[model samples]
Target: MSATGVVNVDDARVAYRLHGRGPAVVLVNGTGGGDGHWGDLIERLARSRTVVTLDYSGAGETTDNGAPLDLPTLARQVAAVSEAVAAPHVDLVGHSLGAAIATVLAAERPELVRTLTLVAGFLTAAEPRLKLTFELWRRLIAVDREGFIQILALTTLSDKFFASPLAAHLDALAQGILTGTNWEGLARQVELDLRVDIHAEASRVRCPTLVVGCAHDQIVTRARDLCDRIPDATFSEIDAGHQAYFEASEEFAAKFLTFADGLYSPRRLSSSVS
Candidate 1:
């Protein structure tokens, strides 16, 4: 099934798509992220369960209206998408900045979330190294866009991935970013990333939570702090860097499916909906 629409929330028009069948899984993309960022994993996950993906305001097809942004406001946008797509509860997968938004939703609107997966999430942007990295990103976007893209690739991929045979695939990804990146939207997201603070929200998430960490992530580090803050949150570490999900799709999917299947009962959506 294919149904794509927009949900109005405050000043933003959030673009969303719901497809596949069985159970419900809502995917929230990170900074400058769109559903396509999930790549092959989307098709794999969609094969067995209904998958919902959305564009945050100022990203992809979503409209920002030039409104100022904050973490909660972004979370509200995600919450709106969840309400439009899921039933009583839906499993949530959030990566990077998306993780912060998901954390807020699971905390403020616990009933809407069945389970939570925080991939490369952070409790705060106060970390000196992470903060410095974001600052450098913003500066690079202003002075040298290609340099910024290169830096992004550097921070996202690990040394082992570089040695692997996926250089061609990763090169294609970098090319896509260079050609298709939304500079304005990305600049805004970089600002939001520097300001994200979800420690309070993390404490309130009561649903079964998984915290995924990357071994060589230069962007977001100290994953244990995020896990420790969330009560009983489980922790898992992947060998790749920040973009582990993309670099290690099969492993990430296997881990994700295992966690999600244990929490949600499969409920297929009919081909046609009223």
Candidate 2:
């Protein structure tokens, strides 16, 4: 928190949390995730690698500009984070919409990213059922605020994770969400995500990639489609739902470090992904 550099991206001065010391790994949160959302994962990854968490413009710490946002707009912010942290190349991990941003970044700015991880990512929306689900998500957020959050959680979380300790932590969830959520931003995010089709965009990613999916995920169900798109991608699934980062935090963190270590072999990784 001591005098970190800020880059003005349109209306938002992107805020990035930088810590540890080693090859940089950038953690990009989902559509509604703020900087703190990656706390559990970052804490574990930081033991051996520098981790930077960022909020996309109009998402969390970044300012809200009424300007229309798409994947391209978000990718620019990823570039900003990489430059601000002085990371010549970064291992980018993105969840939900952030995963899409990471895909675009790795594809377009290949030099900025060395390895990529996509969790519960919306890659191929060709399925009729998933397309319907995506549309329903859009409408819910546009109309019912409470219903949107409830359904959103239902789609992203697995039953096991919900029944676990996190089920009783609504206070923690609410607090974390309140950090950067507003009515307008929520609506805009819904609109942007529903409209995005990252299938064609994903094929452009050439970096060694890892795609994670949840068996019971309610939100983004195109995990298999995402796995198939990347040329050299490794695909796996966790028993938990879309919020795997929290329910299976330790597991996901281990997988993250392992995959990233494989990309940068100069230093061996000691963290566990299983």
Candidate 3:
């Protein structure tokens, strides 16, 4: 739940958390959110690997000491996490914009990454309507944070998430997002968000990849088209939306771990004594 450790990178102390204990996995969260956004999904994959999630430069409890927040900068900050942890050939799992960053990292550092799993991801600047959603996020953060969270609840997750049974969870999710650090860092993230395309470089990924599209995503439709862009990609479909990580946690985990395991050669670890 907390960052496993923090280290200074340039002007910012990037905080990262590690889960599980075998091969490594790094999770990237959505806009204005942090590693915690992966919810139970990270917990599930940790069953067989050393999964790492981070509080981006200013997001989560990780505070910003003032660093560049542009697209390339954000991309490298994540790269720094891989570097700091000495993760050798990682499998990256990212959701929404987090998926975008994971793809960029896979593109630039193919050697460091063994595979990539993108959930609810995209190349929005490449989409006219999707770019408008980025604008709306800017307006909300600039004018109304709570409103942003409320609607984001609608956009990222599904109507089912807001339906009577799951409605109460909204308060808890809001608290997490509101309480996290990175106010200006998040804003800077948004500014840089407007300039890039998640799809532009999808074709560049050379590692084995699995792109999962939520069959009911409300935030970015055509998640499949985005998935189709990857050259060496495999695909799966979950019956949830942006927050499918929460909605379909178990199914997502099973599929993710299986896909990730396929990327690596067999290894031997010390046997657990029963």
Taken over the whole model, the C-alpha lDDT of each candidate is: 0.86, 0.76, 0.75
In candidate 2 the C-alpha lDDT for residue 55 amounts to 69
Per-residue CA lDDT of candidate 2, range 1-274, in tens?
2235567775667877787778888888887777556647777777888878876766655675677778888889878878888778888899988988899889899888888999988774546766687677668767776676677667777778667776897666765554446657766776777677887778888878899987778766768888888786889888887878877889998888777786456553432232
* Reference-based TM-score of each model: 0.93, 0.88, 0.88
**Residue 135 C-alpha lDDT in model 2:** 76
The lDDT ranking, best first, is: 1, 2, 3
lDDT-wise, the better of 1 and 3 is 1
Per residue, candidate 3 scores C-alpha lDDT tens digits across 92-169 of: 888777888888888888888877888888766657767888889889988998887877777777666667576787
- How many backbone clashes does every candidate have? 1, 6, 2
Q: What ranges in model 2 sit over 4 Å off?
A: 1-4, 175-180, 267-274
List the candidates ranked by TM-score, beginning with the highest.
1, 2, 3
Per-residue CA lDDT of candidate 1, range 1-274, in tens? 7789899998888899987897788999988887768867788888887889998876888886776678888888888888887466898999999999999999999989988999999999999988999899989989999898888888888998888887768768778888887778889999999998898999999888989999999888888899999998899999989988888888888988877775443452311111
Question: Cα lDDT for residue 217, model 1?
Answer: 93
lDDT of 1 at 215: 91
